[model samples]
Target: MTASIIEHQDLGTGTEEPVATAAPDLARPLIPNPQSSIPLSTTPQDHHIARMAAVALGLTLIENAIPTPLPGVKPGLANIVTLIVLTRYGWRVAAWVSLLRVLAGSLLFGSFLTPGFFLSLAGAVCSLVVLAFAQHLPTRWFGAVSHSIYAAFAHITGQMLVVYLWLIPHAGITYLIPIFATAALIFGTVNGLIAARFMNSKNEMLIHENNERHEIG
Candidate 1:
């Protein structure tokens, strides 16, 4: 008995051959898109808000300087506005405001080219960095007193560093520590009080809260 094996293949003979599915093109990252990174100031409202904040910051600095002594020692009354802006807007905006104040204040006081300008610039830069960091700290942990102390220390540190490194290269620069520390303590206390008052004030707190909510909304 011969056994025959039958193999059958079912091939569609009437239809066109099946098209092979093409592999998908790997999706590329959308990078360097100017539309995404470029900030569009298309609205007048944005301009108005920026202008108002600028004016407020400028006026605050001038007014705060009125009561300060020794040209560099003050309660940092302008910092109140800065703190507010830091909490309200952002670090970038706060930085801009701080820079604007320094530049404008320098020009207004006619110290644009003097040592005073450099000192102020140094102090402002240090303070902004400190405040930017402080803003992220827990409010209860630092509040105003601790923030003031830190800021004062940073300010003094920046000033003294500049003086030691650039202004006075002599070894006798260390002698100024006592004087600088005293000034730091006094100004630091004053700034603490100012900051505490500003932070604790019901009206200011309410305004800040409302503004924050508005921004979020």
Candidate 2:
């Protein structure tokens, strides 16, 4: 392959000529062929979901750093991002973010396909199911806090079921439900407040910008 550039003869002169230069090795291929590389065909919504998922995954990493008293008990900091996505986009995008966070988080922590992964997956699915119906609730009463709380409860409930049926298979596990539920309530409310505040700030910023634009116009 050959490449050319327009070159001026003098510092002040605008007259130009094509100067040949060595081009990138097309034969070797700088970029892999689409078929060979198997790139994903994605749209704007897909990109949006991916970006949201990435943010949630970061939160997951952060949550992992925080110490927990017991196994399977997490603050679920990523769900805050999911709530934001759900209210802004809808359940589908939120579901995508939640599931992606679980999958990606497991892969990142080297726990993919493990019991922990399944537990995480079950929690995500249950939360998403609750969110699907919760989103339809009237905005007058139900908002981010309600949705988050409901989702958190659903998440813990799902995990408890998994623990009793698959992992432990003992009546003792049910006793831990209250402990998990309490944790869910506390963390869920806090997460909901944070998400609500963030969304409010974002909306106010957007409103201010729009008002300034209108003034200029």
Candidate 3:
């Protein structure tokens, strides 16, 4: 009778132990809850940001489609949009948008794996990095013009570096600098003026709207 009682107790203990272990395992979450998991699809702010990025990208594509007299001379018009994004949304978001623009633009232009695509990629990356750094400066000091100038220079520099290293391995690469510099100045100034005008106009409108809202409220 004593042996039987002990055996019965052992069996009960074993079953209960398995049940307890299995219960905890079942209760565990499949994925850990992260603090950064905001549902962007439903969030109003994210929706607005997405809309802005899309619009900016559209404008960039339009600007890029415009043919220049020179082969490599682009107004860097898309860069103006990127600068605005960096100023408003921060670097990480700007970087993402810039990269997407490059990939999409490459595909759209049907130059996906060409040397030109690589050149554009290098220039775009350099521009974004320069713009990101520029955003940290006081807006009053650098403003739109300086930022555009610096970004344009960086873009040209990056393209030249890629060309010299990979694309054109000739000794005549140095001669191209004068031409790129001149072109950079012209395009950079034009884009800078456009950016400044756009930024200032937007600011004015926002202020006016805020004042009207306050009066109504």
Please provide, for model 1 over 1-50, each residue's C-alpha lDDT reduced to its tens digit, 9 standing for 90 to 100: 00110011112121233333234324632223535664332233234235
Please report how far candidate 1 places residue 130 from its true position, in Å: 2.4
Candidate 1 residue 131 C-alpha distance from true site, Å: 2.5
**Each prediction's RMSD to truth:** 21.3, 10.9, 16.5
Ordered list by lDDT, greatest first: 2, 3, 1
Among the numbered candidates, top lDDT falls to 2
> Candidate 3: worst 10 consecutive residues by lDDT?
12-21
User: Candidate 1: lDDT over CA atoms?
Assistant: 0.63
Better of 1 and 3 by lDDT: 3
lDDT of 2 at 127: 95
lDDT of each: 0.63, 0.82, 0.71
Model 3 earns a TM-score of: 0.69
Between prediction 2 and prediction 3, the one with superior TM-score is: 2
lDDT of 2 at 134: 94
User: Tens-digit lDDT track for model 2 on 42-64?
Assistant: 34455567778888999998888
Q: Distance (Å) between predicted and true CA of 208, model 3? A: 9.4
